[model samples]
Target: MQAWGYVSHQIPLLSFASRLMNKLLAERDFSGQEICHVLLNCELQEGTRVVRAVDCRPYEQQGRSLRLQGDHDDDAEVVGIYEKYLSRPALHGELTYLDFLANWNTSKRDGRKWTRWSRQAKPRVLYYFPRYKSNPQHHQYDDFCRVKLMLAHPHRDPNELRKINGVEYDSYASAAEFCFANHQHPDDYYGTPNAEDRRPDPDEFEEEFHEPDLLDEDWLELARQLPDCPPSQEMVDLLGRRDIDIQYDWTPHVGRYADPGIVQGDYWRQRIAQNPLYMDVEDLPSEARDTLNAEQRIVYDTIVGHFQCESEEQILLHVDGGGGTGKSYLIKVLSSHLQKLARNRPSPIWRAAPTGVASNQIMGTTLHSLLRLPVDRAFTELSPADANALQNKLRDVRYLVIDEKSMLGLRQLSWIDKRLRQVFPARAVEFFGGISIILVGDFFQLPPIANKPLYFDGPLKDLHEASGQIAYRAFNYTVFLQKVQRQQGDDQASFRLALDELRGLKLSIESWKLLSQRVQAKLGQRDVDSFVLIRPMSHTLDPTLPHFKFLGKRSRKCSGAARESCGQWRAL
Candidate 1:
């Protein structure tokens, strides 16, 4: 291990970040309660006990920080706490916490609360976690940054970034990372230089590096507006509601470097359910490929062929299976084919899911929420705000795998169709690749929701028909991952038997057992969940502009944390 000298604030930041990250992965939570317990103990056992519990990000020249993400001064009830408590160095990570006293002066005043608008306001933190940032370079390591930090854990109050076993300490722990890809690490030393080692090469850039420009207004404004990082529960609940799976990535270890670089002018085209999943032909086997029946191959061929082209157009795929069938398993398997085409790596067909739970499957939004349209108090069909929001994020996605298509109806089918058309010109454009939409679900398991379905009465009559224009052309491509997820005993025997049994009546396979056994020793439970929520990364940066900056990471995309691409921002 390299010997350390002192606990410069810069160094403490990284070690603290790494330790906290380790806890987030290990304990699966970042709340002060959970984090503080572990980090504090670790610090005490190791001996550093000084800590400053401030949570403010320097937003102004004098270091005034604004309310983090959710609290909005735009709303009134929360104005008091929002103004006083929100941006302070620390405040329970919320206006209030369990078993704690309320801190706002907007007390009952006369016992009875006032109006409806007043009820809407509260001193609660609004959470906003970004689902996916374009991850151009996650596999490469050339852009990693290093800093020092102490082992401390964060509590809701003073959520410090580092911690030890069960105590709180302040002395620096180890390395931390700060990134400025396209720029290298600053040459200035934060504190006194290491005494043992002689200064390296030529003119030391002593004056060149100093405290990071803490008063950059643009930088501060962006930080103030960054969507709040949502808690895990919010994320999981959202995805589960939409049937999206979830996964976490914590490899970078240090602070900002752990996740991929997300710039202001960008938005994620898809979710990062997991590092793209892959499949090896060696493991899948040619014999296995040969054994697939014609009907099965037809499904495979259409789906497998989608990636051969490059476009942003729309495509819809539908697969039907019976109860007990492995629709989800099949979705995963088929995803491999698409995954191979999506990324340059040899990993299996990747189905990048979302970190944030979403209401809508496509863009990590919710359903009822996404359905809001352009009608005001006048009445509209879908949510224009939501659609526009989605457009910016999903404009570039080429492949779409909609699991549970069997549960879809005509209205949804039409809504999605029309939406896709609106975004791209005649599907004939190669740049659109006729956006592929794969619908996988066991119709036998359940049918589409009634009333609002395509098969409903009223204005949606043409929607529910099997002979309508949509019926014939809805899913040009379809495949059934007929194999179940958890096929216990004899997989081949059971797979064949299950299909044979359902030959007449609807049937399905659950591939959980087989899948678990297949990668049990490798990936635990699951890492990548396709659930997502998206918003424009840069309110100012246009979606169409080509990559404008580079900081770290290997690829041109801003990734990792190096010291480059410093002056990349331009006012829109």
Candidate 2:
């Protein structure tokens, strides 16, 4: 049977072992020629051994009553091979003969260490209690499966094993638990090309695939801005019959991925048609269209999607510009559009900024609050609990929007990626998916307090390198937003001036000196013509407020007069 290695991770341990045994046995065999018979299913009438060598078990004193897997004693390599099949570490030599060790036979071990399964039989759960017949403890506790029981055990031929094909698990929740323990998922086995027979029942698939439910607080206030959805009779029925929830992708609500071509081709033929907002891209008002400048337009077009869905890697929405140039405005405007996009689909979204100061304007909670990282926490792989909690909290959201992307540090970005992939292993948070992250900020602002600036060097760079795994995770994915819409036609001149300086776009040295001194000096007549740094703040209040917690005490020299008139800054 065909199976996706990744999704199979969600299956339970027992089911996993069973499936592993079946798949491994079916794929390879004891005899090279006989194996081909097993593969074809054409020579079923012939009696044949079901499986080849099993992983090892050594005997006491190198002598057991019988040889195993056709070896005279025990074949160390066969046992080692079994471990490798289970993805367990393999031993280069023999499995250290545990039977001869001092601890051997010290206690009555109840569980089976090695077992062989048969078709048409309930798995014979092997158990080993010491073979002490007349021992004092044997009288009190049942030590073995007595002959009475063994004699009654039913027997079946090897052909019956083929009947034990796919597992018939009871519940999706149970199946999910099994899948997780096995480090696999149902999706791995269900939709695989050769494993169609193993697919979950439609009802179970629905439960497994649906979008996660949303929390009441996750919605933006009064954000009922429905997307531009087209109406259709089939969609009307689908929406009317289903109790679909608007959720994000990391959690449970997500279903199987649908082809956009199928979605967009006869997309409208369905019950719930396209998103309310997916009409003619050209007819959108120019202001709405221009919100994504030339560069942004290129990114939007390159995304190759209609509405967002799950399973992708890396996402970068770079909105670069100076202050007040409408960078934040574009994001704020798109917030609803984003919400509508996620709401319209089956997958959910998780949105946050990389820093506290920046997060305040966007997600309402602090970055640490969403991440749950302690103040002194060092970045590491998220604990299973942390991963579980994050998955639970982040199930369904359409996108991740980070304000002040420029301030995001390496550790911060790494943390986000690890946490994201842990929860939604299919579509990593760094990747683009149903989520289209919009990063709003200027790179020139600041990097992390613990990381090097994108352009920083020396001390900062070395420190980041020494930070270990957290720093290593930093290498995942990267996106840089570019554009300058924040400044007005003339206001952007400030950045152009700086860019000019760096690119040898020059002004005389005297002009540069005059501009730098503006922060300390009053504007002279010549300075008036240059760019003036204006604070919307009034001149009357104490200047001390500009410095946090530095409000100066009220001072009165019998005749009140301003001690310093003012300081004006100039930029060329």
Candidate 3:
């Protein structure tokens, strides 16, 4: 491979072929021997400069005996391959490989299978190729830069040269011919002079990357004021309701200058009930409710009491706890109670999390999916049609339980609040659109990414962050669970202490020694089967581990040993 690497221009082609065969063979049940036979039989156009699969210039060898025509199945399979690999807009009406196959008889000379090769009859148009900005002499550096540039242009279309100067060609083929005639690479025509050949001028050095200066302040002061903003009609209607928000205080809404159905309060009670989970919460055993610890009971009772109330007052509560504190257990109990209260109506209790894995644990969806929240950006105002669709989708959702609150960033929560308000304009003034929201998770686990945490204090950056902080602060009550339910046994006291110290980032010598002892311990055969590794991404694990099962009993033994505390294994 290193020997062939010197032919740098062909490296990409080799890599592409390797990936193509790997994917093709993986999809089909082709053995390596069968693949080798296919490669041996297939003609390799080594001298051809292949830019695409279509450019491979395939030709049949003499007396190889061509497959009979009218085999629809084989033809269809070949067509499917072309469609998957070579069917791009540029080749839309051109004579593709399929067309060449159809016209094979015409191209054959005295029954010989070989055909004459020529440039494709494409439309005569101005051709463009990006200027290669690297020195070809330094092949390694140039190859890297070329790969980066190739990746930047994902779509295989010719670019429009902004300044054509005197270098112009009617087609790409003509340009290549001109380059060959001049005994120079086509890239050299437009490429900037190499570093050693040309030094930077004073004007180039003086170039500023900063934004250009704006007009004078007196001119900027003439900037017109934004139009008078007003809340959506639904918000006005919600405020007008005598049943809820009696004061009708229509103060201006905040966040992103933006932006369900169901009635207020017990209006959900009047609607026909249809349970989505297909389970009767009423059938849940009394022991489920009875098993709650004192701390859990307080939160459970407060939530249940609010659900049973006649008023439409929104409940925003946070259930804060550490690991193994029965927070999940409490959520299960509360979900059941909420279900029982809602009766036959669609379970008003919807659960969501910042991530899919966390949501799956509680039989919920991710908040982004559930709320149609934007990724990596602030939420924008939705179109009327989209808002209507979102409203209908979430009409029956009265209570939302968000798990893994620690992973929920300020910007994300702000998006949630903003989206909910837009969707249920009537409840726009209320935090999270007047829906009873229950937040459950340990802050000690993992903090939000690229954004401030829910508990972020100090100075605020922008109104976006400020809005989320305000929404979080709106939670009327909080329940803190301190019990370590999972590792409670006397035998696991040391493990519990270690976990506690680890969470607080104040690990003691005692905890460290306990962890060190485990590091030195060996795993038994039974331990290997029971042990499971958890990672945020599967790619983070050993890539070759999946191959262990295919290597038979010996590899199984190797994998088991690899799982042992002290065992070490590395691929050569």
Candidate 4:
């Protein structure tokens, strides 16, 4: 039957038959014809039926004729011996002819040995298939299968395994042992088993499977399973559709799992597309240019000059402005102009702020988030991979507008300088990666937290000098926005005078009296509903009033209602 099977498949077996006959004739002391009969019809059992020798005479005649061809001379014997095993099956030690055939077919379908099969099956075993296969009564057997899969998968997070299978093993060691005893090696089988075949139907196992909540813990667990690279645009969009709120702090972890370049590129591309910053110079909106006061116009002109200059000649600019000046408005104009110029390419203009709230006001991201700097460590301490990602992100950035610069520290600024230098090594001698940087903030508004301010001129300056760090010296141009666009007439003049006096620590009695007049009397009987009372200590005020309190704490309800009433109230 085996000989006929080979013949029907058109598989050449003349050489194999010759080698078998020759071996039997030499080793078993049997004639070539007897060997042929044994191969074709012998059952190798006493009293079993066997075919008559006459039926196998054809095969014996062919083998004997080939052997006779090898008897003439030494050269003929050598050639005949070579031809004998030329088409013979290359079976492994102790493996049968059937085993060799099965292995050959498997190797043809998949290259290499079972190594590839083991690797391809490992992830599916641990991640795709559930722990159990049969009914709940066969839970023990299912546990054995899961444990076997877990053993095959290296770098397996125990927590992830438990979460995926919805079962926690007492320990990895115990799980490994259980798998060893119950699960058979894949090599013991002919082919790789399908994960679905080993797993019960989804409907049958739905009750056992619990979907994890989309919480931080689950996100972290999922992140652990992902490969270290930036995610593709599709993955990011899918995540957005799912409304997974990936926090800024989690970016480093998430970034490693996906391709950072793709994520950041797609993110910024979408942001620029959605932004209203692409206007022609001639068609610049009146709101951007006409609304600026004289002081703001000068600051705007300086920023425009920097943008218009050759990239190599552009200088870092600092726009010093108090609370009421239109600094934010100027930044918008500059951003729009630059973005419009580079609409065909990635936007050269980028905005960042120290705080999330401040960044949100300008439709930008936190500086640390933009830089991908670790919150717990300095920017200089970024990992090599993170530093490369940061460099790639800033490679095309030409203009960076940093709002609330006062809150940024001298050390942080130096770190920024160092990182920029690393990104643009050719321009390391230049300031801020040879990019036009506009720092917008009033130095007197809020000093840097837990560090010396950028403008500090005391021992901090000496410390900076000793550390070879550049401070405000990096700014080649400075423009002050002095016009108080938020207030007008006596209110504006009086407020300026009070601020100046307070800054100089020389508040005169006249200045104090001028401010006190704005404070309404708390004890007096007043129509609180008709007019808003301005008290120094009051947290809540009437919603109809033009003036709002700027105490230490914010009254969300009162402020929200007042903001809703006016529809245009800018928080002081």
Per-candidate TM equals 0.29, 0.34, 0.45, 0.41
Q: lDDT of each structure? A: 0.37, 0.40, 0.57, 0.52
Candidate 4 structure quality by residue, lDDT tens digits, 1-572 = 22333333221233344455778867865466667878899644343222111111111232331323455574332222112212233432223222222222232322233222233222111111223432333435445443334334322232333332345566444454444565554331111222223322335322542323423445688989988888788887787345455443565575463756465768667666778442122335646666776666655555554444433565476677777777887777767766665657665778889899888777788887777655675345567787688777776677788899878877777766666767777787777667777788866565555555565444443343323236356564556677777777884687787876664457889899887775446433454345665333221212212111211122121111112122333221
Predictions: Cα RMSD each: 33.0, 27.2, 27.2, 26.2
Off by over 4 Å in 4: 1-287, 378-384, 460-471, 490-492, 523-572
Best by TM-score: 3
Worst 10 residues of 2 by lDDT: 563-572
Q: After aligning candidate 4 to the native by TM-score, how far in Å is the CA of 205 from where it should be? A: 73
- Candidate 2 residue 44 Cα shift, in angstroms, is 81
Model 1 spans with C-alpha error above 4 angstroms? 1-297, 311-315, 323-326, 344-389, 425-433, 452-473, 476-485, 488-572
lDDT of 3: 0.57
> How close to the true structure is residue 552 of candidate 3, measured as C-alpha lDDT?
32
Residue 22 CA displacement from its true place in model 1, Å: 70
Name model 2 segments beyond 4 Å from true.
1-287, 300-326, 344-350, 363-365, 380-386, 426-441, 453-483, 490-520, 524-572
Estimate the overall C-alpha local distance difference test score of candidate 4. 0.52
